[model samples]
Target: MTRAQHPAGDPGEVARAFEEMPAVLWAFAGPQHRVVAANRAARASVGDREGIVGRPIREVVPEMAGQQIFEMIDEVYATGHPVSHADRRVLVDRDGDGHLEEDFYTYTFLPTRGPDGAVTGMVVHIVETTRWVRQRQAVEARADDSERRYREARDVVLGLQRSLLPAGVPLLPRLRIAARYVVAGADAAAGGDWFDSVVLPDDRVALLVGDVVGHGAEAAGVMGQLRAVALQALVSGAGVLDSLRRLDTLAGCLPAAVGATVCLVVVDPRTGDLEYASRAHPAPLLLGPGGSARFLDGAPTGPLGADGKPARRHHDRLGPGELVVLYSDGLIERPGQALSAGQAELARVATAVLSEPVAPGSTLPALTADRLGALLVERFAWAGYRDDVTVLVAERQPEPPEPPALRLPAIPASLAAVRVAMRAWLGALGVPALPAQAVQHTLGEAAANAVEHAYRAGDPGEFTVAAGLDERGVLRLTVTDRGRWRPAPDDPQDRGRGLMLMRALADRVEVAAGELGTAVTIEHRLQRPAQVSAGAAPPEPAAEAREVPFRIEAGADGPRVLRVSGPVDLATAGELERAVRAAGRGGLLPVTLDLAGVTLLSSGGVRLLHRLDAGADPAGLRLRAPRGGAVHQVLALTGLEHLVT
Candidate 1:
């Protein structure tokens, strides 16, 4: 391996080695920055092979090429020292498109050494640097996008949470309700916090506040389900305690299992008397006169989460203008310490608010939530829980109901008496051009049916005939009975005729039927003679059927559902069945007739109930209530107890 035979001895062979190297190598002679030699890679990087072989370095890549070329060459040739840039942007055709674009690279040059230690030629190297620059930019863009999506999901959930809170509390005589809801942060979360007020079948006002276990969207979803379940419980004439216990069970066991914490507060507005039950939730603060605050105690259970705990309730009452603050855990968990101090601070804040002109009766919820929310952050500071904050508050303001959403004249027993009452009530209403005579006749027919058919003789049930005008000036009459009798064939002696006449006169008739009972509704509108003259034959109507899927049980709060399998019925035929009655425990839940279950109704059944509802008690024969069809038809037609509430 002598240097001569190694090919290293030939200058031409050494030059060929440089061209074969992978590096983008180049060289310059003397002091001029001219390309004396350029390899294949340098040609490929600039998209020019032969075109750049003899080109000046500055002419091929104008940006930074001229200045850098001169500086490096001078530094190498004059200083006799090597200088290099590890990563620098240079203009080069990246895709071989002949268009030079900025790319990154490393470049270096060393002073040429002659055989006697004098400079002769310089060497240069280039390595493209675009890959690293583009990769870094992509990472930053992805990080920013993730942040934006997170914020959007959070804002949406918070907005929905606020809308679900109770509309401003209604001002009622001897009843004041202060309500509030607090959302902890602007992120996706479950909101099981809620407040509500309802008028019971007994004319009592029921108020409730509570939280569903867990926090965030899933928790909020379960909370909504439980809230609806609780409302249905209270509406069905459930006693406060019974409703609480039953709902506790249902909230933990729906189609999909979930758990909840709830409270029930039923108040008799007239007497300022109140009753309450607390499930697995906080004990409410009852604000007495002069800002005296007391926590009403109740039996507690574990909050409803994936697993449910037994629910317990507390009981109490308040005078007119008394304030009750019901809330979730966000307020108490403000600091990492025990909540006893939080409770005391809440009481102090309450006292301060009561001393001011702020109406604690109506404004307690807002004031309490705002103050409690702030106090929690201030006192807890960095010690706050990572969970979302939820706050709900309510107070009672003693005031009369603004106006009745719907009211009826007390129902009287005899058909003739009902006729008289209807006329008197209508006269007082100043209805013009009303067919009073036709109305009385229709009223009589309905009353008679209610009295005779809605109940089996001696069943002790009664029907009610209520007539009213809707906001649209349409006459709406409802015939409700308690009989759950299943429909039987039309009586051979008397076919259905009462409903026929009533339908001929009314513009629309809706029959809502179910297993429990049936509701027959008839509506009439005052029409213009000109419009009536156009080929407008009166519409002939008959019973239309619907379905009931849900199963319900009576609770102290209202209708405690054991299970609801069917869609809720709101039609006239289903009204009777929907009008659930919870006669003290151990009472019979009859196999009532509801039209939502029927494909059709017999004329005889319609007539019979029409007469009974009109207040007519048939000849002294005791109507042995049939358990199904025929009995249901009789009750629905006669306005029997089975059909009436």
Candidate 2:
């Protein structure tokens, strides 16, 4: 029943009912806030409020003396107003440990009015909320720790996988080579699919592509062993059949029950002579310069480890200007699809890519081999695919030579030309998208610095941009200018970000300054995009999430408040975005985000908020101002404070 409906008959009964209330309730008299009357809960909390009557609150709870509680109580009494605080921290003597224990509570101080409308005393009410707050903190801590460990493990696996893969196909005379590996979308670790090229005794290169039965660390290990053994056998003067037989026997002796399908093709670079053996792998696609494509689907043995079958050798000669494609089944196998259909699709795409005209003045092998492999991976590797794909393109070239380096005048406009040339160069080298972008960004920044800062505007300075792939497939670009070096000004508003951007993007950035000129060199190790989705934009490091440093304080009958408190830089912006999206997911209308606690907010964080605001109903989401701190300064500078409610 409502308290208004239950009439109080006597003062004694009313007092008894007040004493039985659950929460801590008490009254104090005078501005000094001396205890006057307290309920049972208050008495139990302070170990006898009756004995503490007529005493100041400090005398009973000394821990509250130097804290804000005293000032809060005084403010209520003087202004005849009420104050409410949720999640208020206080020190309590619950365990009598000779020291106060930290606790959280919801506290309220209401002014008690006298007959003349003057405040004579105050009523205090408290509800403990320590258990809930502590539990939430513990959960968040555990989640952060778990995520850190998982990321570490994934990085280790990816590093191991990259180390095992070929750095780049060895530059065999008269051979144009390109290869790609697309890891499964769901596999954070490495998979079994791999490609390798090893030079044999008579200037012939053995191209191999293989796929183990399963994926992950174990399968990658087996794939590594098989690849190593097969390459060693060929180096030991074993023929194609002998190498396959040896690999089959080796697979049988492995401790784990592992099986694999492989295609081994040995090609004489001088004559386009090829002797290939397929162990139930996808038939190799041969593409001619005239746009005709054919798959060599000869009678082949079962996958390796099958006891009764010996792999049969098939002899083929790649005519001059004809390209041979070796691949794993992951390239063609799809759920519930016929293998023939996939094969047909592959032949059609390969033919189309081959038919495209080579860039004017570009060699046939340089233009076609790189373009074909990139085109296939770009077209086929869709998101959520379960298999790992490996494609290797080997073609006979006429004295395979490197692309020419670029040189340009030292001017701002020259940066764009340099960028285009570098991109084309990196692409011809078959560098994956991630490293390609890194090289392009780093090179562009260095070139811009040279054009704008290294040379005087009217000095007629010329900058040269030279790029080359090293023996181990590392792309190194050097931007050199003839003018002296000029250090960037020490101004946050204008200077020094370019160098930071360059260092962040490239594997290594080295700068040398002499009287003649300044040179900036950038190095990036070229490898297949590891732990990344193919055909999709590689996950930008700027968008990666660090620990989420924020909290949500909520109430049953009011707007939910999310308080974010940390430097929201590029790495942490994603976490802040996620926090806001999660809060909105509850359909909790009129959710208020309090940025008062935020120490910093970057442009990325600001953009994230704007995007959310653009998608949100204006009345459903409100942003509180960042109250004169670094966050406030940032919002002011970016003109983002207008988004605040």
Per-residue lDDT for 52-161 in model 1, tens only?
Answer: 65666666554333223454566587767777765453444445453445555677787678899888868888776667855754453334434646654656765566
Candidate 2's residue-wise lDDT over 245-346, tens digit each?
998888789844246888999888777888899887888999888878898758778988875489988888888788999987787776777988778878
Residue 108 shift from truth in candidate 2, angstroms: 69
Q: What is the lDDT of residue 631 in candidate 2?
A: 50
Tell me the spans in candidate 1 whose CA falls farther than 4 Å from its real position. 1-154, 162-168, 254-259, 305-313, 357-645
For residue 601, what is the lDDT in candidate 2? Answer: 50
Full-model lDDT for every candidate: 0.51, 0.68
Error of 1 at 123 (Å): 68
TM-score of each: 0.36, 0.43
